[model samples]
Target: MKTSGNRVWLTYVLSDSDVPNALTLCFSLRRVLTSRRLAVIVSPKVSRVSREALSYGFDFVFTLDEERNTAGLENEDFVKLFALTLQGFEKCVMLSPNMLVVKNCDELLDKEEDVQQTFVFAENGDSSILRLRPSLQVFNCLLKQLAKRNGTGVDSILKKWLSDQTSQLTFIDDKYNQHLHEKASFLREEKNIAIVNLKNKTPHELDYVGEMVLQLWKSIYDKSVLPLLNAVANVRNQLL
Candidate 1:
């Protein structure tokens, strides 16, 4: 699929139980999306994503079929589940599997300067169940794998935006009769954790965006539109 000048594309990755989540996301998203395309990456095990998603004319639909490529390697854990999803695209306006698109996002990718190669994402706080608190071993494994890649920026981009340390220590687990997480202390300060490339300077700060609007635009333009443009330019596709 040629991506040059394709406009923005909404990319989503869904699991088996996420069929309803896909429906909710797509129906609501269609109303707000004017210029971009919607690309859904679904688990092969989930038939609903393919069946129910047909009417939307998604720009592309991919499946999570691990049998087709690399597995068991250290990088597999980080990119394994997503490889099938990112099959043909280079850049994307990605959303969490559970996010809901409430407002129009046509010009959300509009950029300022040429700094559109950066990836924009929100931080999942320490208290957030949505964020993964990987074991030290898992952390090291992923870190080593990321180190070998070319400017993937996986490690620096992810941050443990912590929540109020004092409040976190206040909640005692009824079964254990003590705080499950470590008590707040100077060594284990949990607030004001900064996000990489973002203006996450304080507790009230939103996740670092780092010329977010611009970066988002770049991602959309490069991943969704640029390849299409190249294809058309080279006459790679007869339809173009």
Candidate 2:
């Protein structure tokens, strides 16, 4: 695998249930990304076995410090914020585990921008696939806002924060982060989509387009992720 010194594809795993999604995302990314490195931030809720499986596909596996003040945040939203604190990376594409990369995303890292700015898909203005220059300053600013707006979802806080700085915010084409549950008729043709966000539903629950995307996701899981996970489990059992 090739490696880019300053660009990385980042994701997070907050629990054992998220392991499959993260691994699938990592494998899908590996298929399309040649130079960019892959990384994942895992919370304590994830098992050792799961972490081992993730380490197989991702170049870096970060552990979220349990001491961090993440109270009242659902799904360990605070862990995603840590992407900003990742020193040494010029650009980081933070993606949600539920997303499947359908094509090359190198164009995202090629965008020339300062650390004060952030790039996100126009679809949800959420963190489904966010591109930002890693900076401690921005990370702290978001943490302060998160505290002020207790009980608010991180996506809401991020949207409001970005809204406050319209000039610094860049909305990428919605094709980059298409939500699977949305009406298929409203979306661009499947060939143009860069990523598919399988919001909480399986392929069987979706329409034809969604079924196709989920079928691809399942294919990656079975051909790549599942085999790696099985190998990890086998090695683990032998040690025990």
Candidate 3:
């Protein structure tokens, strides 16, 4: 597949079950006309079928090496560290698959270029969205730190790591990573909100905000993702 650009938007899927969410996120980014290319890192648990489906939506579909696929949530967080090892990209915005991009967020890439620090995170301490300048040195350093601080929450580990760094941590606005559990009034009034992190909750489980976001996600899936998935499936069957 062709590269979208030097800067890319990225997500990760640990298993086949996460494919639908990842596709929705990708299509949402496209729907918002995000200029950056899209990419995903899939764990070994994600099957070939899922990877093929992802390739239909993403510019790059990366698989985590088997050795890096350790167990537990901490290990799962460890998988995300691979984003730093991506060689070609000068900058990458890593977002959770459960997030929906509601507005054009190309500014994130532009803003990141101005920052002196190598990493950008939401001020609210949500690791759901991150902007990073990918480097093998940074990735290896974090990997060692993570190993030493095993069992710590990834957010905490990251905060501690940044605290010790010579460069100060740069923070993105909270509107870019709004959580689903925020007050309904806040969700409704936030006109500048660029992305909504669903916290893994389904529409039926949430209030009005959930339904509204779910409708948007469904619209993208039905109008964009579903058709592409169908086409990919048909081609796969024909090849078989």
The TM-score of candidate 1 is 0.43
Q: Write the per-residue lDDT of candidate 1 for residues 43-157, one digit (tens) a residue.
A: 5555542434432446567654545333233331343224323534334444443343444544334432212212332322221111121133433444445446565444332
Candidate 3's residue-wise lDDT over 98-126, tens digit each? 89998998888776343456677788888
Regions of model 1 farther than 4 Å from truth: 1-7, 48-57, 68-90, 112-118, 123-240
Best by lDDT: 3
Give the distance in Å from residue 43's predicted Cα in candidate 2 to where it truly belongs. 0.6
Worst 10-residue stretch by lDDT in candidate 1? Answer: 171-180
Q: Give me the overall lDDT of model 3.
A: 0.79
TM-score for all predictions? 0.43, 0.87, 0.87
* Residue pairs that clash (backbone atoms under 3 angstroms), model 3: none
Q: Give the alpha carbon lDDT tens digit for every residue of 1-240 in model 2.
A: 323668888899999899999989988887885478888988888899999999889999998875655444554577667777887787888888999988887787777653466545454565677787777887778877787785677788787777787665667677777888776642446677888878767545567778778788999999998899999999999999
Q: Note each model's CA RMSD in angstroms.
A: 16.6, 3.0, 3.3
